[model samples]
Target: MLNFSATVNQTDLRLAIIECGRIAYERHLMTSNDGNISVRMENGQVLITPSGVSKGRLQANDMLVVDLDGRVVSSRPDRKPSSETPMHLEVYKAREDVRAVVHAHPIFATTLTVAGLEFPVDMLPEVLLTLGDVPITEYATPSSHEDAEVIRPFLKTHNAMLLRQHGSLTYGKNLDEALIHLERIEHVSEIFWRAKMLGEVKLVPPEAQAKLLAIRDAYFKR
Candidate 1:
């Protein structure tokens, strides 16, 4: 059986996930039960959304608790873990810094992945500083270990990535940071599509890009 002491702030974390779900839904980032979210609790248990449930309607009780090894330690008796749990587990396994993982199918980002177009790193400074180069992992069947393995390499250097024909996965030191990365990816994808409509795209100079990264690093360190 899984073992851990329940933390006091779980209610707050669950509410945060619920609020994020509503925002993602209202923005049309996820439809029906299309996305999943997970937050690491103080006790090493992960609080995650249940499978097949509409994210917009989730309540605090809808969260499930599982250990790092993916063993269920606690949950509402009726709720099951998200189908994408393994992907979240793989991320936690690969990066000690990540405390939350979000999987969403925002229209613009998913559309680019569906069309096999990569987000141009040279087009946006925010994307460079916040997300780095968002790589596309090779296609793998969803809810499978194969899917997690394909993204393992990029997870170390990137906070966000497109899952080939699937959707997008983003991680961070906490839930809010991860959500910010997802929001930025969606915005950048939108800009890329708009630029395509106007004419040929323009890119930031390589030297400028390096400066942007340096500035971001310095800001974060301080």
Candidate 2:
């Protein structure tokens, strides 16, 4: 039921996936083999990071292709699809517009969930305008079908989410946008955490927030 994008050179997409992983690792969005990245192909298959490989050092050939059903379509003989494939597949199944997904254990974002601290997203205009509200999914065992189920309700309304006591999930029309969403989550979390330590943090005025949401809605419409 998903409408795939136009044809894109698979090799280039593989390289893009590699770059996303490296940047994420370098930025500390994820550490070691802590995260997964996937990009949907025009043919409806997905290019994803291989299991057990350090994302920072991923090679183009290390990527695997899998159908929406989470079966491997193409991959090196020695490679396996990410263990989190079910989570990625659910994303594509539930949202056709999502072309890429980035799941990472960002320190601040994950810490927010671990500490059970609420993120006042409306306090930041950039967050309100770009990401709206990022909801936290109930705790689900990692890499399981439950992971998919827990995030299902949030898919329709949010492009970014916090996994209870785990990490974050973000997706967009492309990998860059998805990565940016992950970054925004960590950035906003760190800011809110720091502000809470400094003292009580004031929210954006309600009237201004309404205006920002209007702009956000108009932008998303295009």
Candidate 3:
């Protein structure tokens, strides 16, 4: 089991954050300094990416440790947590089960939001089972407490959301799951976009969608 004591060394968590950043950047989920990733330590502190740094180039030491209230507990002298820290902290506070959060401006997903489109929840069984009904949060000022408030209502029912005219936010029991959710969001968006370009997009039957949802709920129990 992982340690969560006040004195627990954060080396592993920092490395995980760094790797997540690198993967996100490489996969084009985030570019430049357009995204943030965080993992809540077992002790209730959070390790997050620093501000204004390319996620693809992040180093483990660039991670900042902060309390749930957004107070810095430890960080490199030159580093500061991402400006959207409140948004990340909100997920941790609202959903005790969420240990990691990822926010990114993925191309396809953000495009859907910019066009004011919602994910077709029953169009694909994989998406329905894995992500459920992806909600689009009302537009909120970036890096503000409003970002937190807008997403709070969906916290109990959704693991992934598209930020209106912004990007996407996804969280899970760990960094891996969170990242997977991020990737899946973009993947489904691209598929939907491509399908529209080809022809009418087919959807699973309502009966099948309901069955998949029941299975998903029973399995995730979220």
Candidate 4:
């Protein structure tokens, strides 16, 4: 699998952000001007999606470089960092291991958030192995400090979460993993929704859950 970690230059990082946006759009995870993505660079700077643009339509030059304090560090005519810049910055500040952050509003994940369904646990080996628990942040005004604060507690334990009534957030050691986790949440939500329609969702037993988690730990190490 091609991953952004193959990158070693500034150009590669910029293009990776564009790829993240395109992948989100292709998967129907974003539309219009609805999503945000960011990368914390090796130099300790940040590259983020500009405000008020479609993620699908983003070009390499559309990215903005900012400092830890959200000050623009690069030149741009009209583009500023994403309004959700605070949210991305907070994740990076809180999770030292997270290098990339992605926020998108995929159908099933957002539907589950809007309908108040918590992310499932032990219902499927894949869900448990991929994400132990997808936390749901309390609803707060979007693009505000209040929204950022709601997710503060989950950063250490989760790689993905549903942002109450707004969208979903996923972060990782690299852009590919971050984007994959976002997609994984949506896929898991869809699977559970369909299974519920068939009957009550079948959950994996505790013993089986432990074994699957062990396997997941080994797999993640690779």
| Model 4 segments more than 4 A misplaced | 218-222
Residue-level lDDT of model 1, residues 1-222, one tens digit each, is 011123437878888889888988888778888999998887777999999999989998999999988898898888999989989998988887777888998999889989888778779877666667889899989988888889988877778898988888988877777788888888889999999999988898899999988987877531
Alpha-carbon error at 178 in model 4, in Å? 0.3
Worst 10 residues of 2 by lDDT: 1-10
2 versus 4: better lDDT goes to: 2
Model 4: what TM-score?
0.94
Work out how many backbone clashes candidate 4 has.
Answer: 0
Better of 1 and 4 by TM-score: 4
| Residue lDDT tens for model 4, 1-222 | 216553446688888888889889988999888999899888878899999999998988889998888899994798888999989998988887878999998998889888888888678788778878888999989988887899998888888889999889999988888888888888888998999889888789989988998988988632
Return the top candidate by lDDT: 2
Which regions in candidate 1 have their CA more than 4 angstroms from the true location? 1-8
Output the number of the TM-score-best candidate.
Answer: 2
What TM-score do all the candidates reach, one by one? 0.92, 0.95, 0.93, 0.94
Q: List the residue pairs that clash in candidate 4.
A: none
lDDT against the true structure, per candidate, is: 0.84, 0.88, 0.88, 0.86
Q: For residues 22-93, could you state the per-residue lDDT of candidate 2 as single tens digits?
A: 899999999989999999988889999999998999998999999999889889999989889999999999
